[model samples]
Target: MDAGTELEDHFRRVYAGNVEAILAYAVRRVEQPEDAADVVAEVFLVAWRRSRELPPDDEVRLWLYGVARRVLANHHRGGVRRERLGERLRQRLTAVTGGDPAGEVPERLAVRAALARLPQPDREVLMLTAWEGLQPREVAEVLGVSSAVVRTRLSRARARLRELAGDELTEPGHVLDVMTVPAPEEGR
Candidate 1:
């Protein structure tokens, strides 16, 4: 294939394959679900612009992961971040305004609140394992750490989360699993 065709083909395959994975990564790191959408867009935009640098086959997913992690870091540094999430949240908010609230269960909210209290590093480790369903080695790839380091971090994160959650919320293997549950929809 010519360079243009080659890049097009690479973009299609990588975009389709890694979109959800990248989105999940962004959501785990970001404060809002809509920020996850901007993350997804920016990631793909970089891939499109730098298609020549993309790796072959499934490795492109890893490349996207690296890009997303940097994008999130840049955003945290107050560098050139956009409000893709703001627009989506506005739409979702408008749809639910002046309507009955659909509540997140009290327990789930508590768990989430406790999670939010954890240090960002600890939270990311827990989320990479629990929410993203990544193995320690795979997580190592995403976070640029050794597998042993990821495991150590995951263990510490889990303990911190459970401690923050307190005994009433304690349920082995399920403490951080609240991230797995979907929230209730409003005005649907």
Candidate 2:
């Protein structure tokens, strides 16, 4: 194949193979699915522009993940803006829910409140593995860390969540199970 045909094929294959995972990763990081789509678009645009410099498939996957990490960092730097917008959204939601948002169920509210109290990194680790259904290795790739590190973080995050939930949550594979649970629909 000529260079153009080769590039097109590469792009097609990469997009087909990685798009769903990338979008899922982005959704776990960002508040809006639209924002996640934008991040994915940016990642692919960079891949297209730098195709000449692209590595083989395995390395390209890592590179795309790095791009996503940077995109999330950029999003975080706009934290105040996002917070203000979130507050406005919360207000609107409260209004729609008739202002008694908890609505007679204290346990669910307590769980959500406890979740909110966890550190951001812990939450990210939990969301990446649980909600996104990524294996520890893949979670490490997204976090720009090693698999061992991901495993350690996952352990600690689950422990913290269990503590916050006021449950013993102690089982041989409980942490792994927690990490594999689907993410709640509200945030990601």
lDDT of 2 by residue, 1-188 (tens): 79999998998898898888888999999977888988899888888888878889888788889988897788777776879889977766665456463443454454556567788877887788876888999998999999998898888877777778665444654544433433333542
- Per-model TM against the reference: 0.41, 0.42
lDDT of 1 by residue, 1-188 (tens): 78789779878988888788898899999887887898789889898988888888757888788999888887776533346556666766666443543443666777788889988877888777776678899999999989999888888888887888888765686666556633326443
Model 2 per-residue lDDT at 58: 85
Cα RMSD, each candidate = 17.8, 17.8
Which sections of candidate 2 miss by over 4 Å? 79-188
lDDT of model 2, residue 38:
87
Most TM-score-accurate candidate = 2
Ten-residue segment with the worst summed lDDT in candidate 1?
179-188
- For each candidate in the order shown, give its overall lDDT on alpha carbons: 0.78, 0.76
> What is the Å distance of residue 64 in model 1 from its true position?
37
Full-model lDDT, candidate 1: 0.78
* Backbone collision tally, model 1: 0
> How far does residue 127 in candidate 2 sit from its true spot (Å)?
50
TM-score of 1: 0.41
